[model samples]
Target chain A: MQIIIVVLLSILTILIIGLLLWKWRVRRQFRKEEQKRRLRELELTAIRSQMNPHFLFNSLNSVQNLVQQNKGREAHLYLSDFAGLIRKVLNNSEKEEVSLAEELELIRQYLNLEKLRFDFEFEVLVDETIDAHNTQVPSLLLQPFVENAIVHGLQNKRGEKHLKIDVMKKDAFVLITITDNGIGRKAAKEIQQQKNGKGTKLMKERLNILQQKQGEKYKLTTTDLEEGTLVEIVLPEEK
Target chain B: MQIKSIIVDDEKHGRENLAGLLESHCPEVILVGLANSVKSAIQLIKNEKPQLVFLDIEMPGENGFQLLEHFADINFEVIFVTAYDNYAIKAIRFSAADYILKPINFNELKTAVEKVTKRIQKKEENRQIRELNRNILQPDNPRIGLPTNDRIEFVEVKKIVHCKGESNYTHIYLHEKKHLLVAKTLVEFEDLLKEYSFVRTHKSHLVNLKHVVAYSKTDGGTLELSNSDKIFISRRRKDEVLQMLKTSIA
Candidate 1:
């Protein structure tokens, strides 16, 4: 009976040891996942930070050009609006995600800022069917796409320059389309091949991080259409 | 009490925001003509002869520092505006220069305006030698100035080794034996040195190209100074520094 008791005790000890090892393995996995999340957050923040200054520098250049040409009053109005918009961006940087309504407001502000630089040449279209309040997006996500449209698409185009932005919801996903009547596919391919433009490269990086964090829930793509170029972003509806 | 001011920025918004702030807070500021580019700023300086300028550090083709290069003579005070925080800002502060961060804070704006006012007031009492010395430094130039215990010394283009930002003061290492302490911060020195051959290798260190003895590829990278000091190059600046080094060597 004593021998039987000893064997039972050994079996119990083995089970306990096995359980502890399993627990440790689970905890290690959890820690690694947390670390990855933190790294992604840092990268997203870095990308978002780059967007504002990039746009600011370019916009300021446009304003400077206008002022040198003696358009002081217009420059004043443009600057006032730009300041207001930038203040919004700075305030929003503290939050991880912003409401679709807030994002739209930011986009409107950005469009207005760009309007100052482009004068009457720049135009934006927002589809009224989409309810922006129900959705959420990464802050400053839409602006870069719009900016890319302007920089790569509309800036050097020969004919009428127009930027068309469409926001629509389908099932559980929110789709944002920005199309610019600028240069054709050849120019875009050429520009990308040059690898000199920092803006396009930055935009891709931000989109990649957004996809990684959300886990294949966000899709961003660029395609050259007959009118100009089409840039589309589809994001999952926040639960 | 009239602060003679000119707007020196390429952005319409930057110029307007500054103008708006001056109009609202410092009403005594005489609105001088605005300049968009370095060339224009130079022309405006010659023509308008404004005593103060609201300058933006970055422009499209030529940045604000290049504006100083255009002028053989300078007789003005500058308040820099920038969107991003960089080592350059520390350099500018180290030089006793005034600058405001973008999305301009009202309180900071008020302080900068006040500082410009005080400088204008003190300008008359300062000696001609000091004025000439400053002219040699160029009022609109963004090069870092070293400040000693008693007086602020403007560093000539080639004599600087590197600058390390230590708390409130910037420790400027010179090619010569005597290192100086600038009352300004590192961010200020960075701004002042934006146009020079200096680049921020690390958050705390800004190195002059003339003093980089050798560069060693390690963790991120490392630069060996003339004094055999190993300065760690930041990952963000590695590509930029390498490109700059290549150009300089070429």
Candidate 2:
């Protein structure tokens, strides 16, 4: 009887210790995952903080040019329009995610500002089936790519330039496409050697963090066209 | 270099204004074709195959930009002539494309044609037009064109650290310790940049407010910029500087 009790007690103690060790390992993993998430969030904010100054200064420069040319009335009008854009950027800067409609509005304002400096045509088309006002997306997610299309793809071409943005609903995902009729990626890469552009890398990092927080796989792909470049991003809809 | 050129404008007055200016000022530009609409312009362009074109942006039916769309490959250079399109003017400037505003000034027209003549002589690649279209399409990330003696350097406006006036020239100090001496006056830069977070802290100095890291009260006043340069603040401008700093805290 004594021998049986000793064996049972030993098994019980070993089982308790084993259970405790398993629980501790699980807790450590959870803490590590939590730390990783916080780090990603911090990185996102750092990237977001580096925005808007480029557009803001260029708009001011345009106003300055108008004033220099003695177009006082035009300068005033341009300044007022610029103020509207600034307000939109400031309002959206604080948001983690914004309605699809709001994001589009911001993009429209951005394109309008760019229209002041270049003679290019652009159109933003959102599917009629998707309710833009109700849908939510990560704030300013499309900006870097749009900027990329203009800077790398279009900036060095000698002829007509066109940019188009299409946002369509694909069942559980939203498909966003940015198409530009400028110099293709191959030519652009040759011209601006070693400068693959910083926007895409930052964008990928952002999307990765979003994926970790929400267990949906986001996708981004770029294709070089004969005349220009096409970039497509697939993101999950807000549930 | 003799530039074979065409004029595309819907208005007779607009056409006359540019034609007269070219006749009086730009001896190098030879007029080859004239078109009143985008369709006619495309036809004229296809037929003449001119080396240069003076395109007016606004017109009935189709506009000047649409004419370029018809061409898959653009071989000719374009000098945009417009009345008052704030956006279009900036686009032209950003692209570094030559342009003459309506009520064309004699000196301005001469300068535009002269630039075209130089480009033609050098046989430089038509990079400006591409940049212009790109800037127009992506205005949010547009680069400002700063003219230098040898070539035009396109720099991002946010990259500029400060401007210091030196008589007829302005010394532009950029981020990454890059410096450029431009043939523009400080007053012009000040007027152009005043609204864009730049403060004229001294008679000869214009500081980009974005680069300012700290302000000091000693030695009348001083501003420490992110590039680690200390700028002197004029005694007269102290109040204005303080006010500006307070407003920019956000």
Candidate 3:
């Protein structure tokens, strides 16, 4: 009986050791995988930043044309705005989060410069209920959508082309809506160059990464208005 | 031969501006007529049948796009005059239609006139207009106008099974045992085809989710397509590929 009890104790000790060893290996593997995943996300972010073509060159081209046409004052006015936008973009780097006000200012600068060149009318409306100062979002998140609205929706419009952007707070979410009375997605797809899809795809992945990090919902929807297009971006409201 | 052209814009200033630009810059383009409204423009187009029309969008009652729908046999090519509106440019781009931006620059105007003439010389009839009309009327699953070295080929977006990158070019493999070598990069196809159930499964390949038959996760992952072609999915895009495949099936 003594021998049998000793043998049983030995078996139990081995089993405990085995179980601990197994658990340790699993945790180590999981950590390694997590490290790899984080690295990949960082890599993706760099690629996205690189993929954004230089809109500055085109704006400068317009400015150059203005200067050549002897519209010195007009060129000067637009150049200041363009310079501000470039500075904001450079300043926007290295930060993970930015205030809604700062983001809007950047967008405003972009739109202003574009308006100077393209002559499209625009309005940026922030709802009175929400505090724009305290709200924080992923830096450069909304710019791509705005760019899409301009490139795909408003660029082809005739008459006095009007653009309306509304930022409001819904329950637990901040809603951003950009509307333009221009051609819709259907038309954009038809003349779609090869580079267009890849840009948006990268843009979507970036938004997904932000959503995953915040453990909140991120939704983007593009709807066609009768004469234009409306794009809505829903981001989680978190401190 | 001098190309007879007409200017159509509700704004009297728009018609006058384009007419003046053509007169000054593009000596080869003669402004034959000018109309302020679609109703008058339609009558004028029928009467004059000018080789080209500088069409303006967003008039009082009917827009510029509505003008094309009026005629069954549109003979003239349209050079769209637009502002900074995005949708119109995209649609115009999608239709492979031609247009110039607002505050039109002189160089762009000269280029447009030159390009229209060259295009006319290349083909007697403007097939691009018909193609554009078809694309506008049917928005989804469009025949994407791909301009190859020789001619423009409109391929249905869904029929494409997969695309493989060959350095600077892309090989578009169709379902019916056919392939097209396009001068564009795979990145370009990714931009256009991603909306049509295509995902970048590998660095060198963009596969249509609709074509995926099986996905094997073990041994660095492999997907079996409906075309009997097996593709490698990188570990980086594995999760996204799975999610897209799941959603596509559902």
Candidate 4:
């Protein structure tokens, strides 16, 4: 009877030791996974930070020009609103994704800021057909495309510059089209041949990273329109 | 002595912050005007004619360097402010220009202001031939505008012993008793004198190869001018300076 009790006790101790070791292994794996997630978050935040300075500096330049022309009050007001918008975007930088409505609002704020510089010469047409509640986007993913349109597309042109932004739902996918009417394809081609600077290269790299994050279901396309250029992006529903 | 000053920065907060700091710390510095961009900054510098300017490096549209390009001549002192990290700080060190980092420390700010004040005083007092040499090399364009003082008249490049940039001005040490004050920075003069035998051995100091008397290696190497003044050649540029000296001598 004593021998039987000893054998039973040994079996119980072995089982407890084995269970503890298994738990330790699982916890280590969990810690590593958590660390990777944090690192990814940091990388995304860094990308967003890099984008902010380029946009902020450009807007400030506009305000400076206005102020120089003796338009101090206008410049002051524009700067105040621009700072608020920048603060809002920075506050949202930490998030993984934001609702489509919030993204659109931020884009509107950016457009308003640009409008201060361009005046009545530039126009933005937003399509109201897209559902804002259901759709989500990576924060600040769309503004750069619009900015590219203004800078590379419109800035050098003589006449009116028009930017049309369309958002629509097709089946389970959300489609966004940003088109600009400015300098023709031939001019852009000429410019491209002359210089390939850091700005365009950075934009392409950012788009690639964003595409990878959205998976194979998403698609992005850039086309040279007769009068200008168009950037189209499609995001499929998450599984 | 009251120091006339201008402030230029793209950011509203930045301009205000610098203005506030100057007001509170350096009461002797008289605020003349404030500019937010390259265009306005150029205008203010031309109009106000300040003796000193606190300038920001990076601005929207055209940067601080672009502002320098607009003036065929500059008569003001500039202290650059940058938000860049250590590598950029080192680059400024290599250029021998004074700059303050962002989140400005009050003590450091005070020291920079004091340095400029002392330089101004030295210029006014008519002492220090080295400082006078620095003024002769101050013209942004060596060929066009060379600043001259009553004591030291502007001499041709052939008569110059060495040229150095102090703040916004260049001092040209001449063979004659007098030195010339050129109202331009070092980088400006560097571009203008590229064709001449003037070689920049250090960030702050440029020497005429025709005036170099002896060259010896110490802490990398040192160049002794005809005036018996020894100027240290930077470690990075030692080889280049040596080669230039050899070829010029030959």
How accurate locally is residue B248 in candidate 3, as Cα lDDT from 0 to 100?
A: 95
Residue B180 lDDT (model 3): 86
lDDT (Cα) of model 3: 0.76
DockQ of 2: 0.01
The TM-score of predicted model 3 comes to 0.53
**Which candidate achieves the best TM-score against the true structure?**
3
Error of 1 at B98 (Å): 31
Q: Which of 2 and 4 is the better model by TM-score?
A: 2
Sort every candidate by lDDT, greatest first: 2, 3, 1, 4
lDDT of 2 at B117: 76
For model 4, state the Cα shift of residue B165 in Å.
Answer: 64
| Model no. 4, DockQ | 0.01
DockQ of the candidate models in sequence: 0.03, 0.01, 0.03, 0.01
Q: What tens digits encode model 2's per-residue C-alpha lDDT throughout A49-157?
A: 3345676687778879889999965675566556545555555555555557767877777776676766578999989877565455677777778877887777787
What are the TM-scores, per candidate, against the unseen true structure?
0.43, 0.47, 0.53, 0.38
Say which prediction, candidate 3 or candidate 4, comes out ahead on TM-score. Answer: 3
Query: Model 4, range A1-239, lDDT digits (tens) per residue?
Result: 99999999999999999999999999987865665475455546545643567567878899898889999556755765675466556556665455566677677777778777665244444446554633456666676677677666776677777877878777777888888886855685577666423343444454455454434355778788878888897776643
Worst 10 residues of 2 chain B by lDDT: B187-196
How many residue pairs collide in each prediction? 24, 5, 21, 19
